[model samples]
Target: MSNQPPLAAADLQKTQQGNQVARTPEQTLVGFMNQPAMKSQLAAALPRHMTADRMIRIVTTEIRKTPALAQCDQSSFIGAVVQCSQLGLEPGGALGHAYLLPFGNGRAKSGQSNVQLIIGYRGMIDLARRSGQIVSLSARVVRAGDEFSFEYGLEENLIHRPGENEDAEITHVYAVARLKDGGTQFEVMTTGQVNKVKAQSKASGNGPWVTHWEEMAKKTVIRRLFKYLPVSIEMQKAVVLDEKAESDIDQDNASVLSAEYSVLDNAPGE
Candidate 1:
């Protein structure tokens, strides 16, 4: 064995402290997760395997990508991060299993923003898996004689083969979701609806709905089916879209306050 001097105890402690510091998440809006008001809820919402620092890092990175999210209320943003963690989702991934969309700031008189929490297709699957609710999920394109149909099923037919129909149009896309005890649910979207959604998404600048047409179609049906499926409270919170359309309430409140201020300014003997 080669003879070498061991590192000093003080130096070793310093190195350990540095590593701990490096692992700590930087203080940002997400840092509010550790505050007493949020800490317990975050702990309950987060998966046992996830730590607060990791959750903050994942959400913080997402905020960097979509700068608008920075304007989101800190409490609401942290709640969204906790919801994402509960769903076992990483916001930094390309699929963006969860998103925190800010609304009402650029035009609202209150100048306050609310965060809309929306979950991706993968997040849906992950949430279903955790609850042991999903038995299997799949979709495929199949040709039956002269017509091409998207045949979706649980375990049997997830792949398409060239057994028939040398030439045909893919007329529809179907999605199958099999639940643990409940029977399978089949949802379909015709090519007409597909084109309509495509056009709408394009008009609104949603490139993914056009680029990943097939995947988006499948997700569309699955999200629809979620209306009938019972989900855990955490899952429900993660996927619910915050309704900015209801900003009318905020606007009305602002108007009422403005009227009161006008009356005060126009007093009879000012």
Candidate 2:
């Protein structure tokens, strides 16, 4: 062992303070979490894509990538379209359509888009595991929890329509999340409506899409049962289409673009 001189009183105090801060990171988090206002804010800022984190850095990074339609619709528009693909919405083909809408539209309104998404089974399982709920998806549901869905609906006057030069008042969007039925399952739905779609071009046009607003609602039922579900190996195909694709909502449109996703080893739950 090497001989060492004793620390001065001032030095000892400084070292103790540094260790206390380093070791209490969890405490720091909990201190904020314990605040009712903080809890409410967390509840309000729920993620649209399953279990993504609520941290600003993580959330904004995902949003910057052509955000999922849901997240982009709910969060900052400019933030969502950051270098995202350009071929998915209209002018953008699969190469462009990373998100539901164009990234960095150059004309972002306060709130113009709203997208809905479903959480993946694997993500939910991971969350349950982290919560110490050891149960299979096929087994009797061991985790009964509530979740709040979040999306930025078009409210106020926004949306430059397709052809019209004038913009429209977007009004406010109403969204809510709830546990389905009297069971451990859950779902989110739109309660208030979006109104006032405006045209984009100076010439008269079809304006913005106004129909299909209620198409997202799900009839609620009490969930008396559920099981632990495994991560689906079937993979997911983008059922969406761009203006270049044939058929509007249907008809198989062969994607001319490649698909990708972030490495999700430590991703969060729904």
Candidate 3:
């Protein structure tokens, strides 16, 4: 081997640094979230009740609990988190407000999974209540043995009596929204109708739809009811986002699914 000249101390240090191994995806994600710029972006997107630090902690905790999330497209994952924060909902927590799920992007040659945000039934209810137009809202799955009857007309009426058998098969789902002005709106769907909606969801074969079938069914009815309720714009956006996540449609030719939430245009090391 031959060297034209020995590297200076500063040059040697620079060379060594340049040759260092790159950070793992997990490490890169954590570092990016900790960056001052990313933190500011999160703060700007988050509501007043949540802080950037808390949001970061929750996301990091979720990534640790589900390592697959670390493998997701970093920007898409961050965008989903920002969407949750903007909606005042926590992601991947016991509250079941929202979920961060990974799905294989058909476009990725590397078979990389992209993250999708699923809003839970509870999350939907929370968003609706935030509108302040609703005094109370609730959804339930009716079992085969339950006493249920509902009539929809000028005088809409609904009545249900729970069956003693707690394990009865689910036969129907319904949602009732009580408005602040003493008006009530309700929607009832037979299990067949709910199944039809489920069959159309790209995520029906997995994620919350599989693990939380009853919850998903209830949310389906509530989603139908939302169209008639006086909900906030954020709530409307959440519904659209939820539907998009379930459908997994590609509006643009991006490798990963894009959400409507505002996110940092340039992620770290982009």
Ranked by TM-score, the better of candidates 1 and 3 is 3
Candidate 3 CA-lDDT value: 0.72
Q: lDDT per residue, candidate 3, 1-270, as tens digits?
A: 111221122332343355467766676577667767667767877778889899898888888888888887655676677777777888874777888887766433335667778888888876765555567777887898888999988899999999998898999889887776788888999999988888988777887889888888887888888777666656777777877776756312223232322211111221
Clash pairs (backbone) in predicted model 3: none
What's the CA error at residue 84 for candidate 2, in Å? 21
Q: Which candidate is the best by TM-score?
A: 3
Report the lDDT of model 3 for residue 125. Answer: 75
Taking all chains together, each candidate's TM-score versus the true structure is 0.57, 0.22, 0.82
Better of 1 and 2 by lDDT: 1
Q: Which ranges in model 3 have alpha carbons more than 4 Å from their true place?
A: 1-22, 108-111, 250-270
Candidates ranked by TM-score? 3, 1, 2
Evaluate residue 4 in candidate 1 and report its C-alpha lDDT on the 0 to 100 scale: 23
Can you give the lDDT of residue 222 in candidate 3?
Answer: 80
- Write the residue-wise lDDT of candidate 2 on 41-151 in tens digits: 433433233111233333243334433432222233222221111111111212111222322222223343322222222322223232212222221111112122233
